[model samples]
Target: MSTEQTSPAPTLAEDDVDLIETTSDASLERTQRRSDAIEREIGEDPTRFRILTGDRPTGNLHLGHYFGSLLNRVRLQDAGVETWVLVADYQVITDRDGVGPIRERVLSLVADYLAVGIDPQRSTIFTHSAVPALNQLMLPFLSVVTDSELRRNPTVKSELEATGDRAMSGLMLTYPVHQAADILFCKANLVPVGKDQLPHLEQARVIARRFDERYGRAGDGSRPVFPRPEALLSNAPNVLGTDGQKMSKSRGNAIELGMDADTTAKLLKRAVTDADRHITYDPVLRPEVSNLVLLTALASGRRPEDVAAEIGDGGAATLKKAAIEAVNDMLAPVRARRAELAADEGYLLDVLRRGNEHANAVAEATLSEVRQAMHMVY
Candidate 1:
């Protein structure tokens, strides 16, 4: 299911005409070198880094989440890097109206994390709204960046475009700054993000640098307040949905992490595949079939070409069955654990409570330092 693909050109504002250029091969080489170095560094001394990565409680997480970033989070946590997973509850409304069953969603998200081996004991799982100090950092953070910088942010621009026709909120525009607060609050030095999110990380770096330049001096010695976090770019595969489009809960093409075996099989039955009797892993020629093959490979920890060759002449039915079996088998334990955790709502809430308390303590310390650095401690 592998194919040669070019990175999508970032959707930039009209003013960012120069920034719209495609990624050069040399730039990619440098990124790859940096990624390799980071991996080695993490291996040598995992304690030297703290990672902050999270999701908005938009809906139930799906396989796209599992393979994309969740697994990486688990790996980093297991490797002993200090991990902080924030449930971006407040950011959910940055674009949408009304919080819809937010409490349930947040709890469910925690359950998902726990089910997938994100040890609550090791990783702090907190919510955005509960950490007031973290959000408060956004005030000073915003002061460092300008309106044009926010508007030019690629992630914000893409989100705005997604909201199509809806008037952008002030919160939505300052989303990147809020993200910076999320990272810097805990002083997380590493952030797991995809290439598309590089711009947002860059904005966070800019804010950190500007804030330090403006307010990071107390005496003759310079004391930088915030660390400019680097992006630990993900190497996860681009997993498409059942319909051959991007896997999304909104599109109803996602296989949710909470779905039982029967439900997952039923959904896979509807997966779009070509009428060709022969099965082959030609992503460029047969994207839909190749997507299914990739899913099965990812699920079973096998290679896509091997999965494709195994079902060479069996056609779509065999492919779908293999995918169903592989996915269901992999998720069986996760589903079981999720259901068990879901039954104990109090436990989930307690996890959030503890995480929030810890996050607040850390944020308050950071904010206090920020104030002291800016000579606002009086």
Candidate 2:
């Protein structure tokens, strides 16, 4: 396999910061307005709300994955929305890495989903590779998106830079088209994503609109086959790693979802902090310490400033100890659940099989409609 340097993944906080700094005030306001409109729509009808979300099965999920999107997914499922969770194994090769460990990673990802409360009864969880029609959908989607548009995608740019901008495979470049298919396959109208990912969703919308203009309309001039999916932003705070960078599996800074108390403690003890023993929550001046405070706040359900105030004069040792306790307390149940789920390989496979069946049915129905719309059904 060809080698490339992938950029270290950004923490949720970093993603927000980078976007906030770069986005114009008018653009931010526009997004906020759109969000408010979506919020109102969210309350109108639960049955009409269809959400699509998932992770690449490239590695184990960590706390960054937990707070950022996982929790929101569970909430959506419980709230009676038609939720679809995808294991995007097809996307893992965007970095040109071979598929040797993808099978194990896919199973581990399923185990993590179960452990984190993603009920198969509520959400359809399927592997991307299992849905043949989804890949077929990508072929038409690619027609609407131009090469320059793909080149301009921020996520693609970031991934390319991460891999030292080398080994720029065609698969890597067209992954966004595949993603568009993922969202449209289920006719998902709501996409849960970070601010940084809004562009990808925008591209999906563009593709949907183009497809509709060309072949999505009905004979009676009714609704289009696919809805222009909207971005459902999360208010969750970014969870940085011990190094104060984005918590990532590749970076080795992440505390994995299945880590035990002992492992959590060891990791926290070495988390980057200041030389001074004083504890404060000034992220600007003391990012490393502030990162710890933020994690504790999320874990213990306390405010970061309040946690800082409570730990006044306690120094780095006291702060780290508190973080350790809070993180372990938060993850202990998750760890136990993961262990139980992992022990039952047969059960995990069954869940995947069931989800795949459900997803394939939906994707096939949509693809049939697409083919009919384009006069290819015969």
Candidate 3:
């Protein structure tokens, strides 16, 4: 969802505040214009509007994933925007020392993309590891950014805290640079991101400008190598899991996209709630139950208070049953679609293989220009 919905732009610490405002005047204006154009063309010719978004194949995607990003990706694709979905397998190991079942997760990720309405004909779905050129691009990008700059990234800090790992891997430290490579590889000019990712996107803009100033100019003085990407901030609200924290796989509180009716009900029954006997939509006082209200509203396209009122005079158990029915109703189509897609392993493999070929060709072209710009083409 849009960062705006997530509370005001986070109060940046003095040191970090400047990083957010570091965009050059010219680049800021250019990005603003791009943002405006995207708004104007939402229902018009979106072929020119290129969007890049995807997920890390760490595990199966959950309901939180659907509300937060997967839904927006489909909207953008349906609007005729040129969309590219990346399965970021490379990012899976950045925090942990080792990982398992990556190949399985990648396949599952692709199935979810399809089941969620991401049309491969309209959007390029590819794997990160398939694009070797992205790694090459990351090498040069790392030099342009400093350790202090990387350390200041809020996402990295939060992730470190989440993992409770004192020692940060070199890969974890540099993933932002790698992310820049991903954006620039496809020359993606529009990114759908939440508020927390503002720093990472801003850093990518800095990297793009730095590369352009150093090597993007031709004899004609045109900087065509990369377009600084802009964030299309989502307005969707954050979705909490059954246990009342952020919905995540490791937390074991998430409701995966592939769950059936019985599974959805079981999870909702165990959702956290306060001791109050009455039903109300006081998110501040009863976040656990209100979270269920929010989920029902999102699923039914109604207001939370209205949903709370409809389930009048009931406690957490009443709310749980309502939420279960609403969620299962919403997920019925997605489950059926997922099941159909999962049955065809060969077709899924071909989809990725074809997408990989397309991605490799585009990456090679960008890498060639980058090598030439750096005078490494001898």
On TM-score, the candidate that comes out on top is 1
Model 3 CA deviation exceeding 4 Å by range:
1-18, 22-37, 159-166, 218-220
On residues 1-378, what C-alpha lDDT tens digit does candidate 2 reach at each position? 222212232344533443343246676567667876876776677787899999888788999999888888888787788889999988888775687598888999999999999999888999988999989988888876667668767877877788783678888899778888999989999888767777777778777877776554534448788988877777888888999998988888899998778888898899999897778898889999999999999999999999999999999999999999998999889999999999999999999999999999998888888876666755
TM-score of 2: 0.91
lDDT of 3 at 73: 94
> lDDT of each prediction vs. the true structure?
0.87, 0.83, 0.82
- Give the per-residue lDDT digits (tens) of candidate 3, residues 1-378: 121222222222533544656355665555556666777877677777788888889999999999999999998888888999999999989987777899888999999999999988888999988889877899878766778778778767776787674788889988888888888898998898765676778878878876665454423446657888887877678889899999998998999998888988998899998888678888888898899999999998899999999887787888888899889999999999999998999989988998899999999988888876665666
Candidate scoring better on TM-score of 1 and 2? 1
Model 3 clash count equals 2
Name the runs in model 1 displaced over 4 angstroms.
1-26, 162-165, 218-221
Highest-lDDT candidate: 1
**lDDT (Cα) of model 1:** 0.87
For model 1, residues 1-378, the per-residue Cα lDDT tens digits are 222222232233522432332144565566667877999999999999999999999999999999999999999999999999999999999888888999889999999999999998899999999999999998888776778768777768787788799889999999988999999899899999888877777777777766776566334436678887887889999889999999999999999999989999999999999989899998999999999999999999999999999999999999999999999999999999999999999999899999999999998998888877766765
